[model samples]
Target: MTLFRESFATQQSLPPWEARGVQSWCFLFPLSATAIQRYLDEYFNFAHPEPAPFRFSALAEAQFGCLTISYYPVIASTNKANMLRYGPQTTSWDHLSYNEMYVAAPVLCNRVTPDNLLVDRQIVWIQPVVMCDNSSVVFATREIVGIDTMHATINLRPGRAPGSLHVDTQFSGFKTFSPTTAEGPLPFLHLETGSPLPGGLPEAATREDKAFLEGLFGVIGGVDLVGGVRPTTTRLISLKQFRDAYDLRLATYQAIVASTATHTDVSDLRFFDPKEVDLDFMWSASAEQILSSFLQLGRPGDEKASAPHEGPGWDLVGRQVKIKVAFAYTNNAVYDQIETLHTFGAE
Candidate 1:
């Protein structure tokens, strides 16, 4: 059974654009209000201009960096009620007052001093803000000429996490695209009692210890070793994962990593179960149709059509298409377990 489902009934349609051919395109252009003001002053020749200033408000200061704009074509629906209800000015999609639509600014700062250095200090700072939000209010301005088409440009910036988990979740959902699977029972490598593996540690004397050791081995073996030695003997396992095997789910993985980094006590950890979600869709057109659509959105007006090398995620659609399809899983839990054969009492 699916863990979650979207309520299509809640969706509202706005308008349709007119164009030619079977393809549609959309664009997202992210820019700060400061940049917009600069563009207006330099290119459009604004009559009045303010002198360059070093200090500005926190909001203004936050807008001085890079931003993100997302764009996607709107597929019109035949339902007239849906269209009129969500049309243009009356549409909730265009209303910026909605909390979910508002962009938030966040600032991160850190300071550190080296242990051995006589006088060494470091400080890190990050400020992210949302600049603008825009969308095309598609209206049936003219009759559909063969196939419908429209071009939209949305101004965006680093904003607060969109309250709607749909977008982020969709991105996360794609991570397991070609997940590794176990086709058969894995071989067991037993360590003789009192015998240590190559690392100088004796074979685990208890089942729990053996399991912990195996989990550590899995993580180390998965990575390439330098000079045939693992980077660190410290095994990094999620607190949630550890809890799943032992029934503790109140702890967090980040805390575990942090504690281990500082040599803090981590005697007890919480755990949870891994949740999985999947999505599948069938399009009428061949794969080429989808590829062409993505390419057009990715590099508008560019003739060269190339698939992005980056793994599937937000980076794939960076500063290009605003509209995208994605899915995600949350509250997933995993556990590290020991490998050992146990015999129950039998006649």
Candidate 2:
């Protein structure tokens, strides 16, 4: 076995992070494919063989409406030995739990094998924005794994109806586009889901629902018909890089990392009708500038002009875009691990 060096400060003791009883809510919506591609190409530093070992793209121009917003009620490292390794200080800090939310789009990562012979292709989620309430999680996920994670205030509470949830996340950003505005916690995204409809899958499927399910299963993979269940082992890809301390323009280290999270026990697998979903996004100059693609706000000078609304952003109601899928599940004994798929800079 190859032993690795320990991390510094808060995350030093916990090498491999694990969680228990992780409950998650997932909502899927349609997004412009061209916009997704443009975002990946410009921000993620993706290119053909030039970025070297790997190339990535959306699953299909038309079939890929795989924009997803996932919320985790709490994420904490539950390993007893890792917690108490260095005694009280390590135990106290390592056990902190936090709420997290991230927006991602499914894409295909086509990579050249280690032998430099054939190409290996796989489906992975390219996460553009990941926010959590805990600083430790922010540092570890960003510095250690290259997950471009940021700190945010995440609130999860029971909705007005039974067995429903409302989640809202805020991050520091310019409330309005002006020199007078100061950066502070502003609205980022909001989600309100009705009670989980009592069913496995909707029997009377609309064209929109069918398209949504097909796009979902494309990324989810593996369905057990006999058992009437769909199990998922999600693999996420991230471009981890560090800029030179002296010259910010130069990258000291850069690599493409692939991470895995598996649901060992999944329960309460239920769906939500389109009518039951209410999702909203507010324009925070800090977060939304990069997220406009996922939100389907067309580029500048486009005929679809921006309609002014209260505050800094325009209101995006769920029904206007026709939300495809809404569901929630509980998973116990979830595991997370990462591996470097390709390194482009520094030994």
Candidate 3:
């Protein structure tokens, strides 16, 4: 119940932000347990400030994916502070439109047991890097909830042909591999679904889609049982943190936060052909550095990547094999609500 009034802001912003008619595009890829574990150790280590109360591990079928979501007509939930700050007579800019893209890994979270026996567990996606196109969304998400959100330019739209989609991202990044390169907006990544499978029903979910959804959620909602209800909610985990202002190397606040987005009036769920999906890592030193570890790219003695394939389809460079998609799907939902799961350090 702590509303934030940032020092540079003119008014207080309330939480429980609400959005309607949110669209999401998901492209999943391969990942290994070893690589995921390494990522957790380097960036999201939960073993600090004393061991975490929950046990964390990668899914049996570990996979990494990029979620690009469009949240239109978003509003900061009305409350006393928000009402006073922007009274009814003068309030504008309450509705927002923004796009976000982030890399997430599915993980199994188990409650630590006193008898060394697993008791309760849940599946959640651990988000490491989250980018948004709106500066207001980025600042609010980063400062209030610790989502590690940053500003980027995102272009999300549909192609000329029916059932085709394209999403592109650009971010200000510098080459750590070569420090002399000047920092600028770099082409971070691209996702394009050329077309749906030939003669396939665009309205019907395919077997791959069913299996993928089941793997992620353990049940296929209405598909799993007769007269069953579709699951309306999913959970995501984030490592919320703030660095020490003076030291720059230490965290003044850190915690593990969980957020749930409950979907309603869901429609337009569709699955695309994996081969028809094209994902380009593009040439950004910053993107490569952050995503390569999760995707097992540029590793020594790794030879899976080959020369660029024919045309502008899947290509490989620097051992970053742009494998054909394991699955690609799109859906619409209503997104809201963030809750903290664990706290390690705080002011």
RMSD of each: 26.8, 4.6, 5.2
Cα lDDT tens digits for candidate 1, 1-347 = 75322235344232221111111111111224443333223322211122211111212222222111223222233334443444554433422110101111111111222332223221111112111122222212111111111222122222222321111211102211244632221110000011112333345556754554454444334532321212222211111111234547521111111001111121211111111111111111121232233222222233332222223322322222221111111111111121111111111
Clashing pairs in 2: none
Worst 10 residues of 1 by lDDT: 187-196
* Candidate number of the best lDDT: 2
Q: What is the lDDT of residue 185 in candidate 1?
A: 17
Q: What are the clashing pairs of model 3?
A: none
lDDT leaderboard ranking: 2, 3, 1
- Local accuracy of candidate 3 as per-residue lDDT tens digits, 1-347: 77554344734344556566666665555567888777666545555666556777776753545444454545454334555554564444456677888877667777776776765878776676688888877777777667778788888888555777777677887634575777777666667676655543233256755455455444322442211122456677777788889999888877877777665555555556665666765544566766667766553344443423333312333333343233333233534467776777542
TM-score of 1: 0.15
lDDT of 2 by residue, 240-283 (tens): 88999999987787778888767666766777776777765655
Off by over 4 Å in 3: 1-13, 43-45, 61-66, 69-80, 89-93, 114-117, 176-179, 197-231, 299-337, 345-347
Which stretches in model 1 have alpha-carbon errors above 4 Å?
Answer: 1-37, 43-45, 48-60, 69-347
Candidate achieving the largest TM-score: 2
